[model samples]
Target: MTADCKGTVRNLDRNEAAGASLQASGQRDQVISFRIEHTDEHGDVTGYSQVELRGEVIYGGLTDGDRVEISGRKGGDGILRPSRAKNLSTDSEIWVSNRPGVKILQGIITVIMLLAFLTAAFFMITGISGGRFP
Candidate 1:
């Protein structure tokens, strides 16, 4: 049967730098599991749950304390077999997880911070910047 859950990553089921699975022959594939606090449809946290997610989830940058939604199925052995995952935080929130490559906004932020700092420095040198130090 398929199952779904939404919640924060409480912790890794065990200690390891990361996880991986071996493909046919000798190729390696990474696997990660997270214990979570399941939430209801209205967003109220319902209870605890666990999932074993496969693949490098696109837009799925997972980290501890991150809230996520997962979809998968339960095996006959009672283990949760997750096939997909997604992050559910907003733009204003700290994205603990991202697809990869630092973050989607990293480049944008570089330009923004550079411009802000340069503008502030320019105004400071010219005594046109707003603040209490003038």
Candidate 2:
């Protein structure tokens, strides 16, 4: 399960610390030192936090010592592969593509409804024409 963490950046990579670099994927990936307060399931502070993370999207212009909130799953390599992040200082939502495309589903449903309506209309029109006038 992924956990939400809020903290300040402690250390950042020298490359991204200075400026964001366009990567081969065309998405700017930057590593940030996040000082988040870890907690257990019982809501107790664990006194441990992820020292470093590569989660911030480049649009927020994250840098060293910037406050941020990130959410990710802890991997077997002891690294937090965050999927979403936001800059606390600027309150900007950086990454959120994990949940979208509902429009396609809705479009499918709409087509079904339209087909049903058209079938009913066809029956009504044919029945009215064939039946004797009252």
Candidate 3:
């Protein structure tokens, strides 16, 4: 399912030096996330939410105090993965997921695995029929 969430960016977590260290060590796939605080009409803090984006998201730079609207589908784990996010304050937009290239890569991997399995099955059948397998 899909959802749209509007809130203020209460904090931006860039991971700072810790992320940099992990990047240098080739283990930088950890997700970077920010906190969002929601308020009621009375300007009273109501609730809070979180938007977690993958490490590859680099289009829209979010900052504290940026009002944002995130639209995306929810995963089985009930996480709202932002396919697109708009920063109302900066008028900037970013795509966080559902990338075409990523989908294509996954398709290619699936095809390769299927082909490998078919080839192995064919060889096994032919060998067994020809008495090649003792």
Candidate 4:
């Protein structure tokens, strides 16, 4: 499931920090940060918040003071992952894509672990049948 929110860009410091780390580690990644401003039924500001997005900024060039509407899903880690963002100030939009290779590697590792467990179970069963149990 996903949710939507509207807010202004508080800072792009996360991107800068991530960029520096990526440079040092020879990795490619970026984090987008937003300060979500909550509103009441009367269209008045009620609260403020912050969210981080793990993906590349594909367009529209987000910056401070840009009003944006973001639609995204909250990951299992309790981080809000943006799927798309529209910069109302620039009248432009940006789409986000999480790195696919990481997910693929996770699936592969899970399968390997399952197979290893099954192999161990099979050997144990065979050993018991051969009078090597108890």
Cα error of candidate 4 at position 77, Å: 5.3
Tens-place lDDT per residue, model 2, 1-134, is 56667766654553343456654334554554545655577867666456444433333456666667777787775566665678788777655232224546767888999999998899787775555753
C-alpha TM-scores of all predictions:
0.48, 0.43, 0.57, 0.54
Tens-digit lDDT track for model 4 on 1-134?
57778876775555543344342224556666767677787878887656676553344477777788887787676556676788899999877665577667878999999999998899876775654566
* Candidate 2 Cα outliers beyond 4 Å, as residue runs: 14-48, 51-57, 96-134
Cα lDDT listed for each candidate: 0.61, 0.60, 0.71, 0.69
Candidate 3, superposed: residue stretches over 4 Å from native:
15-27, 75-78, 97-134
Q: Give candidate 2's whole-model lDDT.
A: 0.60
Please write out the lDDT profile of model 3 over residues 1-134, one tens digit for every residue: 88788889876776433544343224444355776778898988898776777644356677889998887777776666675789899999866543558657878999999999998899886776554556
Model 3 lDDT at residue 29: 44
Error of 4 at 131 (Å): 55
Between prediction 1 and prediction 3, which has the larger lDDT?
Answer: 3
| Better lDDT candidate (1, 2) | 1
If ranked by TM-score, best first, what sequence of candidates would result?
A: 3, 4, 1, 2
Candidate 3 CA-lDDT value? 0.71
